[model samples]
Target: MSMNGREKITNKKRLKPAKIVWQVIVYLLLITGAIVMLIPFFWMLSTSLKESFQVFSFPPKWIPDPIKWDNYVLTFNSLPFGKWLVNTVIITASTIVGTLLSCTIVAYGFARFRARGRNVLFLVMLATMMLPSAVTMIPVFYLFKSLGWINTFYPLIVPAFFGNAFFIFLLRQFYMSIPTELEDAAKIDGLGTVGILWRIIVPLTMPALTTVAIFQFNGAWNDFMGPLLYLSKPDLYTLALGINFFKSQNDVQWNYLMAASLVTMLPSLILFFVGQKYFIEGISLSGGIKG
Candidate 1:
């Protein structure tokens, strides 16, 4: 072989180790991060199975010796967890429905219609996002109180019937990405605007819609302040508020609290795992070019 060829082969062999080392370094960093993030969760799981006395044991037992699975059973027994779960589910479901319906219609109008002051209205809606919720919380609470919605599910679920700025933007962008030819075809077949939306646009936009649903589900499920502000009745308590009350007991049971938290967290984890594929795709598709 020529000397140049042998030199090239030697250089290639030398470069391979550097690439492997770089990859090894990256993997090590990622693994370290994963372990660091998981430690608190591991501690929670361990503490949940421990006896109340064992929770604060020195040096911190990473493993509960004789894992008391009954902690989970006791967690539900100590509170009205089932009723709280039902309340949360109802509020979350209503919020999702209202969000999807209002946002879709408003977004469809923004994406497809050419009306006066369209861009200005869009900007005004977007500007609302800049205003901190703290500024409006009291006024909104007063409005609900005036409407007799305080202590009722209406305060928790009714506001979502109005379009959310971010969700409208996300859905509008997704709508713009779709080709207009399909709508034209639907029109030629005598389908009206609502018909086109329901039959054509919605089916194509399932991924983005699912993303919105998941986002609202997470938000509504974990919300603390909304319920704290409007829901004065214990019978109307959602799981998040119920858990906060659990933490306030004069003699707090860390194990039971941890266990209840785990139960509260399980649905979100399961939903994310089930819909992660669409959630990611939807977000990517939502960043479409302006029409």
Candidate 2:
């Protein structure tokens, strides 16, 4: 073999170890971070299964020797966890449906229609996202109060039908990313605008739509302030607020609280795992061609 060939082989051999070392370091870092992130969750799980006394035991036990699985059962019995779960599910599902339908329709209009001051309107809509919910809290509360929606699911579920700015932006970005050729072809085949949207755009943007659903579902599931503001009745409380049943002026049931928290967290965790693939894909394609 030529000397140049020998030199190239030697350089390749030297570079391979450096690449492997770099990968190993990266993996180690990722693993360390993952462990760190998981520690609090592990602690929560541990505490949930421990007796009240065991929870603050000196030299804290990572593994509850006498696992109190009864804490979960006790949580349900002690609080109306089942009712809270049902209420939360109802609110979340309604909000998801409302958000998806409202945002997508509005987004489609914004993306497909060529109306006057379209850009200005779009900018104005996007600008709403900059305003904090706290800014309009009082006015919205009075509006709902006037409508007698306070202490009812209407305050929680109805406003989602109006289309959220962030959701509209997300859907609009994804809708714009779709190729106009597809719509044009559908039109040539005697499809109407709504037909094109329903058949062509909807299927193509499932990932983005799934992302929106996941986000809205998560937000609704975890919304504490909204339910707290509108739902004064214990029976109407969502799980986020219902979990506070474990707290009182004198005592807090830490174990039951943790157990209930784990239960409340499960749906969101499951949904994220199920939709993560689509969620990632949608976000990646959402900005395909920034308009």
Candidate 3:
């Protein structure tokens, strides 16, 4: 009995150390992945503060001996940076508003109403999400050109009002999770369909709405191809298009470009961080829905 007890104690001690070793390994792997992901942002900051020559230096200096603050100022002065900033802001805001309102309404219809070909239409919408943007880009450009929306913000902002496939799907899932009893009760109180939707459904789905808004904001802010293809006038250029304008045939100012890129990313980053809590909750709630 004494020998059995000693053996059991020894085995317990050995298993504890093994578990601790596995935990340490996992922590090391997570930290390494985080550092790898952060490296590009660090490199951008380093290069943005370095001089033109130092940017191309061998061994890749991580720290600049003399930080050049002029790159940011020069970037703004060399292009219509202010105009680009305003254009991006307007497009992003408009897209967010349109996406939330239209997607929610469409999603509610698909989730609540049972009409002919509803399932087939929903599946078709889902299929569109799988289609590559490149396949439709040229056709969309020509369509917009015929409508005289080229060289204008209309092309950038108007399509968002039609609702996005993925966002509508997401909102539909959330709306399905909401109890039907609430809507039924509102109806008994003499509320119409639109009233129940506006008063009860929208309030309950605030987290999901916020999630859609954040995604739309990010998409509009980071969009490059649409702006490049549509907006020809220098005054209408967004930040994404303005970045291309900075790269001329003869001269490419890497430092200034990096500074401008960093500046362009700030708003999306701030918005994401601020709305992160709701975004997570919205995703979780949507995932819990049936069908």
Best of the candidates, lDDT: 1
lDDT of 2 by residue, 1-291 (tens): 999999999999999999999999999999999999999999999999999999888889999989999999988998888998999999999999999889989999999999999999999998988889999999999999999888899989999999999989888987887889888988999999889888888877777888889889989999999998999889998999987645652577798889989888988889988988885554654533354
Which candidate order results from sorting by TM-score in descending order?
A: 2, 1, 3
RMSD for each of the candidates: 3.1, 2.9, 3.5
Candidate 1: stretches off by over 4 Å:
1-14, 279-291
lDDT of 2 at 163: 97
Candidate 2 Cα misplacement greater than 4 A, ranges: 1-6, 279-291
Per-residue alpha-carbon lDDT of candidate 1 for residues 172-282, written as tens digits (9 for 90 to 100): 998998989889989999999999999998888888899999999999999999999999788999999999998999999999999999889989989999999985554
lDDT of 3 by residue, 27-80 (tens): 999999999999999999998999999998998899987999888998889878
What's the CA error at residue 202 for candidate 1, in Å? Answer: 1.2
User: Which of 1 and 2 is the better model by lDDT?
Assistant: 1
How well does each candidate superpose onto the true structure, as a TM-score?
0.93, 0.94, 0.89
User: Where does candidate 3 have its weakest 10-residue lDDT segment?
Assistant: 282-291
What range of 10 consecutive residues in model 1 has the weakest lDDT sum? 282-291
